[model samples]
Target: MTDPHLDLAARAGVADERALLSAFADNYRAIFRAKVAGLSEADARRSPVRTGTSIGGLLKHLRWMEQAWFQRVLADEPNLPDRPAGEFFPTNEDTVESLLAEYDAQCEISRRIAAAHELSDTGVHHNLGEVTLRWIYVHVIEETARHAGQADIIREQLDGVTGPEI
Candidate 1:
């Protein structure tokens, strides 16, 4: 499928806050989404890197992080159901389609929250004390980008495919 996010990210360059934010989000999105491209249902879930960081698991982790930071923390919604981190972890039951669906849901929820708030809006974090919505966005962007980098390395190690060049 065509990921509008990729296009969106492409439009965002490393300039100002808006562009920077979009760039961060885009890198994160690209890392996970790109890793699964051209892989089978089985290969996508395989921890071929031996680090338990399967492409599926990475997608689930990003989803969990978005919900945790944006929805659960910022909006103060109740924690995401009984889903332990394990649900997102790759097991024999995880499929490429299922992981992508979960990621899409997370992306929708996150985009809604992000659209409604400014980066300056503040929320009380139990650990970090008061944090601005801007911080969360950047934090997620940075964190996601880092993981995406990891995914790039892992994907290459698994199959010889690598880099943004595709």
Candidate 2:
């Protein structure tokens, strides 16, 4: 689904902190969603990349990231369950449906967190000290988009699917 938030941010310009932050959050989700487009559950799990990127792993990372920033850092929620050993690596076992469901749920949580906080809301990063909600949003957008670019390459190599084209 297209995110109107990102569109709104685009119109508002990145120089505006609130609009930039919102757009960043929206863009992160859009990038993740687009990476899995037209792929079956099994296909998304396939490790098409020689490096480490996988659609499933990417989704998992997105989940980890959102929870880390919003729920854990911002809201001070209890620690999430630790990831299993070697979970970051690419694997064939992940199903597209399961991954997609997880992604959607994480995105929903992110939306709620964003809505509940003002743009100036602050949180302590585990390593970076205090930061504004706007910073988290921008960071996530850039980080996720970077991975999405990788996903685009991997998907193309796997099935000749070019991003923004098909």
Please report the candidate that would top lDDT against the real structure.
1
**Model 1 misplaced regions, further than 4 Å:** 1-4, 7-10, 14-16, 163-166
lDDT, candidate 2, equals 0.71
Write candidate 1's Cα lDDT for 2-50 as tens digits. Answer: 5556655656655778566856676567656776677676667777665
TM-scores for all predictions: 0.82, 0.81
Q: Best TM-score goes to which candidate?
A: 1
Deviation from native of the Cα of residue 3 in model 1, angstroms: 4.8
Decoy 1 TM-score against native: 0.82
Clashes of 1: 1
lDDT of 2 by residue, 53-75 (tens): 67677777777777778887777
